[model samples]
Target: MPLHPKIAEILAILPAPPDGPLDPVAMRAGEESQVPPLEQRLPLHAVEDTVAGEVPVRIYTPVEAEAYGLLIYLHGGAFFLGSLDTHDHIARNLAKETGLRVVSVGYRRAPEAAFPAGLEDCYAVVHWAADNGEWLGWNGETLAVVGDSSGGTFVAALTAMAQDAGFDRITHQVLFYPSLDLDFDVDRYASLRENAKGYGLETGILKAFNAFYLDSGADPADPLVSPIKRADLTGLPPALIVTAEYDPMRDEGELYGKRLAEAGVDATVSRYEGAGHGFVQHFSWLPEYHRVYEETAAFLDRRAE
Candidate 1:
């Protein structure tokens, strides 16, 4: 499908990234500025910014329905950008749409807290959220994890780690255009070239993210870095892997979903036709965001039955 006409119109007026090497600070600031005001983001019954085991988390409860489950949402910024504030609206709206208590984590970022540090922070929040079931008002059985872009990468890594640790607490995983494979090679995935430039993820940005997020001695192929490289996808929770039609990460997200299904784990891959990456965060401006939210809510709602 072609670009959604509405998105295309918005893109027309948007400024392109500076034509040079990446500046993490400016990049983060630019992205964060696009988020709507907190009040305009979501209307939740309650929203609390609290700490979970040393990790900061913003919790959201639905306004209209009794909570059905709990979700730990990791914001995406190529692992270097984004924070709880940048994703507040999405988390709150997701909680409202799915009747799931959403905890938006403020994990450490790269250049300052590279690799395992950020991942560990997010992983810790998951455990803390589960261990404090009474406080969160959700049982461990209905817990799930969600993320977009690099945050989705953390979701994939944390889910795999949780399974390996014999903690079957997480029931589902939701990935939106997730960067599952960190060892990115343009030649390896055709989508890299086809959708590399204009669909939100600028070309060469992945490499820039990798350089900042990974330590010099770290292995890119480490399963923690690239969940798609994991040997066994079995015994993992069911997943709803969403990909944007023209996003560079589309193929890899779908590939991860394929691997999960082949490993006998129930996984569903849904492509957003004519949509770009990060569309979920721009719900007020993008109509297709509602479609993804509806699908997400239905998937979680079915698990309750």
Candidate 2:
């Protein structure tokens, strides 16, 4: 499908990244400045800023629905820029949509923290949430995770990492247009080449993001870094891998879903046509964007018997 009209309109005027190595501070400030005022934040039952597992997080309680379980949301800025305030609206809306106590993580980014630092924070927060369920309130029957773009990679990796460490508490995972494979040269997917340029998230930006995140000589092919490289996906949590038709990262996410099913893990892949990367957060007004969250809520809404 061709790019959606609204998305195309937005892309037509999209600004290019600075012509040099991105200034993470300036870029972060630029994005954070766009967040609405705290008083202007979308209405929720309650919202609190606190530290979870030594990582900054914002907890959002929905206005009306009883939360099914706790969900840790990892926002995406290609592993470098994005904070609680940058994604506050998305997290609040997700809480409202799914009735899950949503925690948006503000993990340390790179090329400062580099590779495993952010992932470690996310994994720790997941455990922290489980252990602190009592004080956080609403200990529903499940612990789920939802992350988009680069953050989606963390959500997928958490499942594998947790499985190896024998921490099996997570019940569901939702990956929204995740960059699952960072090993760029080997077995490159056509989407990276076909949808390489025009889309808002171009291949160039992806490479730069990967470079910034992995400046510490981390092997991009490591299973934790690229979930697609995981040889064993069996016994991982049930997954909902959402892809955008025109996204450079689209095929890798779908491939991960296919591999998960092959390994006997339940996984569903749904590609939103005419959409590019970050459609879920950047273009929420589109009916198609809403479907991803609907599917996400349905996937994570299980009540324990």
Candidate 3:
């Protein structure tokens, strides 16, 4: 299928990335400043900023919901750039569509906090939600975790950790075009070459992102850093893995889903034919973005029931 007309238009208007590496502070500030004031008018019952397990978080509660499941959402920013503010609209939309309380976490970013710290913050927030979600209107046992890009990397690592710790609080995980394998052989994935450019995220920039997120002497082989390297994928929560046809990370995300299914985990893969990475965040301009939310909500609703 051809690219969605609106998506093509968006691509045409997108400014080229900086000539060199982006300053993390400037990138974060620029992204946050452009976030439309869409959260205030979202159909959610309430939106609040609070601390969960010492991690900053934004909670979105739907007006028409009751005793809903809770979702701990981590935003996509290559582990170095995103904040709750950067993904506020995405979180609110999820809350409104799924009737699930969405907790968007602002985990510690990398380069400053580095590897384990950000992952630990996200994991802590989930543990906190499991124990204290009732105060936020969650009366159901159903709990889910979701993320995009690097955030999805966190979801994968958190699931593995929770499973190892015998924590059964999370029932489902949704990963959107996730970078599951830090050591992924780029030459093996054709998309890395075919869609490396003109798709918003280039392969070189992604490599830089990984470098910024990893410690100076960190081993990318660690399962927590690269879940695809894990020897075991069994006993993890059901997963809904999404990918974009033109995304550099598409193959790895799809492969992860296949690995989960092979390990007897319930995993579904949805590839958007005309979409690119981060379409969910660019929902306003991409026609396929709504499908991402609809498919996600349906998956969550089924698991919750």
Global lDDT of each candidate: 0.83, 0.84, 0.84
What lDDT tens digits, residue by residue, belong to model 1 across residues 224-287? 9888999999988889999988888889999999999999988999998888888876533466
User: What is candidate 2's TM-score against the reference?
Assistant: 0.95
Worst lDDT run of 10 residues, candidate 1, spans 281-290
Error of 2 at 119 (Å): 0.6
lDDT of 3 by residue, 1-305 (tens): 77666777878898877777768899888988887776455566788898886899998887755677898999988788888887888898888878788999999887888568888999999999888866877775669999988899999999999999998989999998898888745796778888877777777677777778765334678889888889999889999999988798888889999999999999999998888888888753355578688888899877533
Candidate ordering by lDDT (highest first): 2, 3, 1
Mark the regions of model 3 whose C-alpha exceeds 4 Å error after superposition. 38-41, 64-66, 216-218
- Ranking of all predicted structures according to TM-score, beginning with the best and ending with the worst: 2, 3, 1
Q: Summing lDDT over every window of 10 consecutive residues in candidate 3, give the lowest-scoring window.
A: 282-291
What are the root-mean-square deviations of the candidates from the true structure over C-alphas? 2.0, 1.9, 1.9
- In candidate 2, stretches whose alpha carbon ends up further than 4 angstroms from where it belongs are 64-68, 303-305
Better of 1 and 3 by lDDT: 3
Clashing residue pairs, backbone N/CA/C < 3 A, model 2: none
Please give the lDDT score at residue 107 for candidate 2: 93
